[model samples]
Target: MYDWSALPRGARASLSVAGLVMAASFLGFGALVRSLEVGLLPGLATTVFIWALPGQVVALDMLASGANLLAMALAVTLTAVRLLPMVVLVMSKVRLEGARRWPLYALSHFVAVTIWRIAEDGIDEVDRPQRLPWLTGLGLALMSSMLVMTSIGYHLAQSLPPLLAACLVFLTPSFFFISLFANAKFRMDYIAIAAGALIGPLCHQYYPEFDLLAGGLIGCTIAYLIGRAGRKRSK
Candidate 1:
């Protein structure tokens, strides 16, 4: 049995605006799954296993379109590749000097965009020894909330209006942009964000198959080069 009083600081911190936003986002995902006619169990299973929203969405869409297993797997894998850098960043933040490797491996499963954002913003406040626990707690709380909200959304999808459901689906990316703007400390960060915003839609229009990967890579590369030159000029 879990001890409620002994919840980690990270978990406690997550029970705030961040947690609420994540729940709201997953509620839309659940509705999307239902609207696609996927069973609730499979939708919930994606939450448990795939965890990443983009990957789950891709898998659901492919399944709805009757894509073969190999194609669906390839597409989901490609979408999930974006999470690798996030996992590396989060691992660097929370890993202790001599911590066990197994736990870090386990924790990597929870390093989605929302959890990554939470850790990036606040994990430093936790003691080094407790950082892992804090992250674990935060992950669990967010995951639990996602599961519950998803179940609720799935059941309520039939009654939800089209506009409202679409708005709900937009909440996560909207929060992502808001948080990026809010927490940006470097010019490069702003540049990357702006570049991505401008380039993403254009890429989607012309090269829909590779829009996300192409836009992000090009935008960040441009930002890095500009930022580097600026630093050199200042020196």
Candidate 2:
């Protein structure tokens, strides 16, 4: 229904892999939700409309920590801020001269770690004339499987072993790590991720409400300033 016929052979191959990865990670998320007593339908909404796993993780973690609803939502939204630049980048890749623009907008809802990966790999091989439609098909495939896989995960939650549940969650984080790591072609991202990771918990220790956003912003700024100084001194 999303028009896979327009995709190149390579795109389909790449998208299939992406779809599989999405399916696997979602399976994990759903299981975690069930195990943790979070409702599956909310998990589905967060994954569906939000499409930001870091945000979802933060929300789940905050809720488990007894965080207030406002605080939890804020943390989740902060994590989702990463998606803005991603959406921009993906949009830039599309030539956008066709009548399929509505589909592109719709498919944007499905944009996530795995979808982005396949798009990164498949975009070049796809014909320029068909790039948008190809991406639509790819995104749709990934999105379609999530609900189905999540339902499967929900049903299987109690029966699955704890170790197995842990492994399933690895899918989301692993894909996200790969995507974020790819953004670090330059040296600055190293500083950003490292500083943020270090300061993040520290911030939580002090101001629980401001932990994520403040730490990430402060760390990123520090990293940028340090990187800038290094570059200037090198000159």
Candidate 3:
């Protein structure tokens, strides 16, 4: 029973910003699938279903390498494990108490980095009754635009220069880093970012396959322990 007649100005603004960033990022992703030789249907499926650029990239890489479907699935699943906590945290903040949980479960599919970050930063401006709609609108806007962009990228992949196409794919990471720096508000944020940045490269140099998952878990664990120790000292 949420209001749907008119969107708040804040929600509209949030949706616009998020939509633009996501569209730009996914435009590159779409081009990537084309370059990777993954068909447009599979590419669109990944964008609509996976909705995780990193995971989608990994899937594309694994597919290119001729990895078996089962193996690729497992790898992508592992890469996506980080989203679990993000979904839980956001849902906790925005869901109405006593509401049916089914819709929340469906909405969790939209809890990728862009939606999570946008919702985290802007949900405060949205009334509780309107929060879900705001997120849904933002996510759908990004998804639909991304679908079109992916097709464009796929077709342009052949005519585009290698360097230029690669640059296009770089948009997501750039946006992610910018958002990370902008939205970070806690000491733990800095610690986690620093730890992950340092550890991730080292892990990539050593173990390319497991690097992302391992680095994320190790970095976050270190950040949590440090924060806990600091809290104890303060007390």
Q: Give per-model CA RMSD.
A: 4.2, 3.4, 3.7
Output the better candidate (1/3) by TM-score: 3
| lDDT (10s digit) by residue, model 2, range 1-46 | 2344675443455446556666677787777777667777877776
User: For candidate 2, what's the RMSD?
Assistant: 3.4
lDDT of 1 by residue, 98-150 (tens): 55688788889999887788778877776667777778888877788789989
Instruction: Using TM-score, rank the candidates from best to worst.
Output: 2, 3, 1
My TM-score estimates for the predictions, one after another, are: 0.73, 0.81, 0.75
Model 2 residue 119 CA deviation in Å: 2.5
* Clash pairs, model 3 backbone: none
Q: What lDDT is reached at residue 124 by model 3?
A: 87
**lDDT for every model?**
0.78, 0.71, 0.76
Candidate 2: pairs in clash: none
Q: Against the true structure, whose TM-score is highest? A: 2
